[model samples]
Target: MSHTTGADAKGHYFVPAASNYSTTLSIGIFLMALGLILKVNAMPEGAWAMPLGAAMIVYVLFGWFGEIIHENLNGSYTQWEDRSYRTGMVWFIFSEVMFFACFFGVLYYARRIALPELASYEEALNPYMGFTAAWPSSGPMGDPFTPMGPWGIPAINTLLLLTSGATLTWAHWGLIKGNRSHLIWGLALTVLLGAIFLGFQAYEYAHAYSELGLTLGAGIYGATFFILTGFHGMHVTLGTIMLIVILGRCMKGHFSEHNHFAFEAVAWYWHFVDVVWLILFVFVYWL
Candidate 1:
């Protein structure tokens, strides 16, 4: 595949001729998502599918990333390739932004438009079903599940993420300045902060489920709460892993002052995740 003569004398951008990781990754993701959907919807027969998919993807991820990192370490990427990587990462982040935007939009529709209309029309017109115009709707069960506030663990998690962002920026600056020690320490701290943030989030989820009676079964409020924060937590986990990889590369003396697109891409993603959490904290938790 690499020997294929796709480019001619005309000015055309070069692309790697051999890569099959993308299709495999897509298949892994489809399996994971399908299994998750089935499991979340209470399909007992498919309970093990998500774990099976996750295990397969974990294996594939290790192999796939090993190949890419090996290529990067081998100095296979040129300036044009770096630019392509940047463009691709930007588009990927944009897609993630859209994904979170849809979830947030669902929250808005449920709280502002749908709930009010349901309460106004259904409560008055139907007279049999008791519907209320509430931000966290009681649904048919009328169980007033407690909503989490921004004061306690949520606030602490917010602080941790913000600090992680700052630490990441510090690491980037250290990289630009060619300070290996500073870079490694800053990145290590950032990963630590991210881990701590996830710890708090896990505790919060458990508290919500047991103490507050908030769960996936708690209707729209719980669903949005878990989905938004849960997704963000997953991103944090990915970002932490990315940072750990960067830390390892730093120790191996892999990245230079100018040639570190991988670090920059992960930093961009981590900052985006931080910003999303701030929005989540403000609207979902406090409001």
Candidate 2:
């Protein structure tokens, strides 16, 4: 939103103020997505707009979120505001869930339906595709690329995220119990774990590309695997950043046993990301 929204004539309704942030955010997101689509399809235009949009979005998020925090510190949010924020956060998470579902659904359709149909076609009619439908499959035009195993970095990442979740919960408990040290320690540990997970993921990507011949162009297998895990990694990065910010807030004597909606909201988002990664681990890696 461009400005604060609350307290209208209709029994405490939302009010919308005109601001450029909304328009900027929308345009930047549109350009980013458009650039990505075009670049993915090998367009010849200036596809660098994607990174430009990404940079704009980062700037916007920081500015807008900082404004919100300032408002909160000034005692702008009330119980009613908290309720509204909770609802908004819930819907936001649902949107993210739907977003990831589309990718997972596409992966499923490709593996279970499209690949089978392509494979079952007559060899005389479709001689190009040396088709065989298999899990962790490279499509007919793909190279003989090897898939990654779950027993290595992925498994380690799984444990890291799972432990982060536990630490986050411990932090939440500490917050509710008025134990600031415990809360700060837990958040610090969680952030450390998240960074370790990212480090391992980077190494895994290097290993995959250099050793296993698993570049994005390696075929459907590589595309879906990277798309899923790459997006998840981005989410983890964002979540970790959020935790770091919240940790800073905690250190500065922010949040309380009774009022910490911001902290709770970020924790909810972190847990949601964690759950999504678990599903990805099992479906994309082990399965």
Give the candidate number with the greatest lDDT.
Answer: 2
CA lDDT, every prediction?
0.84, 0.88
* Residue 255 error, candidate 2, Å: 0.7
Best candidate according to TM-score: 1
Clashes of 2: 0
How many times do residue backbones clash in model 1? Answer: 0
lDDT value for candidate 2? 0.88
Worst ten-residue run, lDDT, model 2? 2-11
> What digit string (tens of lDDT, one per residue) describes model 2 on residues 181-262?
8999999999999999999999999999999999888789999999999999999999999999999999999999998998
**How many steric clashes between backbone atoms does each model show?**
0, 0
